[model samples]
Target: MGQEFQGGVGQVAEGDINNYGININLPDKPEFRGLVTAQRKELHELRAKCEELGDDPRDVWRRVHAQLGVCSISEITAEQFHEARTVISGRLEQLQEEADKRRLMGKILRSTAEKDARQEMLNFCDLSFGRTQLSHLKRNELQRVLEFVQQVEINPQPAAEIPQVQTAEPLQLREFLLMYKTNAAGLFLFGIFVGRFWS
Candidate 1:
């Protein structure tokens, strides 16, 4: 069975804490918990290795940073992604075979991780975070899918750059006087032409 707590996912039982003395910050965001938990477990395993290898604490952290720098696989077409998944599974299995007999735990983590990744991909494809996996996502949905794909990042506009007053320019005295004179001349000509008729 998968890890469970009385409160919910990521909630450590009081007993679990007493027995294991594990007090790491459990991510509260339910959606992100799986990925965060997997990363934490990997860190713990690496730390254990450092303890075994007599590596310096700073060196261990630096090594972890370097490993984290390894970029995620590029987002690919559905067909290409399926092919990559086949290759990735084969590679993971090979790696797992070399490690201790932790096959079952690895399977659980892998399954959880794949679920999360697929959900994320689906969100992008549907242009919706609230969408489910079984929902239709096809050629017509490409634009929606791209919204969450992170193919490129957008920089937000700075508030300081926004003009406080839209009419920022001062009215020129010369322009105002010219307009007034033009209006006055038109009124004067109108008075001369129409005043005689009224009289």
Candidate 2:
């Protein structure tokens, strides 16, 4: 028999009148830990997906919009979440493998600082910018180039002869921005602090 109360409807609580409307086991979920871990994993997976897409996956996930909605487990079924996770994870793995191959190709560019990496970086810049013919790129790609050059330790120099390549570690974003003001598109991508629509 179903419990009833002052509420004139089905499945109401004894003292208060909150209708469950559905059967929930009320399992030992360890709510905060379980939900938080799931949320973190989902977010991490989404970050990987965004990298594979070469653009923000938040737009695709409708995650920002959904956050506004405050969707519940009931609102978004677990199956949907599972499907999304699978697709994103698969793409992330594929992209990571391809990136490793590209990294190998990148190694050749690194071995000759002044000789090769500059031409390769310039070629990437051109291919990357394509029809726009613009030196500037989306801030993310600009950072990517800066990171690549730094990793390769490609230096600009007026040398008497082809200088020996020396691999310097990647520079911090601030240092790159300061050093390559002319080359860098001048912005940090993928970040926020104190969300607001500023005037």
Candidate 3:
């Protein structure tokens, strides 16, 4: 008699099964199963990291394939999968470290500069972290901040040299009128000189 195939949801074999004409051979050894499971988990984690880093999943997978010297993920062996996992995990850790560094720089920027200045800095650096909200920046934005920080480190600027932001209230009516009159007088003299020249 032929080997009996169980008929239940959980009784399905470990590998892909197609009722048509395709056949996929799954490893029977427990260790091989474990390795495949680990490889899939690591691939999932790397995909998640790619999303967090705002990178294309296909591109990241291609890079992983290149790093492991494999043509495709499907062809990756247990050892190669382990190496890929290590490389991906290291990249994730590096992104986390960069995010931490960006947070520190944001704190410094907030402490030393005003909201407008911080916003300007973010704009110049092509970052998306808001002036009032710098708690959790995306990886790319954090990288932008990291680059800005490195530039600042290379050409150090004194803290005292940073421009101060004026958050004072609007001027009073009398103060506004006085200032307007002073500016008007200068403009009047300049206009007279120009008019005389034209005449």
Q: Please name the candidate that would achieve the greatest TM-score relative to the true structure.
A: 3
Question: TM-score for each prediction?
Answer: 0.18, 0.28, 0.38
Over 44-110, each residue of candidate 2 has an lDDT whose tens digit, in order, gives: 6676666665646655455532543434333444435555455556556655655654554455345
Off by over 4 Å in 1: 1-152, 156-178
**How far off is residue 132 in model 2, in Å?**
27
Task: Report the lDDT tens digits of candidate 1 across residue range 27-145.
Answer: 55543212344444544465555445444545554443344442232222333333433443343444444342343334433543544454555445355544444233332343344
Candidate 2 Cα deviation (angstroms), residue 127: 26
Q: How do the candidates rank by lDDT, highest first?
A: 3, 2, 1
Q: What's the lDDT for residue 194 in model 2?
A: 25
Q: Largest lDDT belongs to which candidate?
A: 3
lDDT to native, each model = 0.45, 0.54, 0.64
Q: On TM-score, who's better, 1 or 2?
A: 2
lDDT of 3 by residue, 1-199 (tens): 3344544433356556545544556656554322487668768877798669655677767777888787777767776767878767766677667766666766657543533345445565553455434445655665566556445522344566767888989989778768799786888799999999999
TM-score, structure 1 vs. true: 0.18
The all-Cα superposition gives candidate 1 an RMSD in Å to the true structure of: 27.9
After superposition, candidate 3 runs with Cα above 4 Å error:
1-35, 114-199
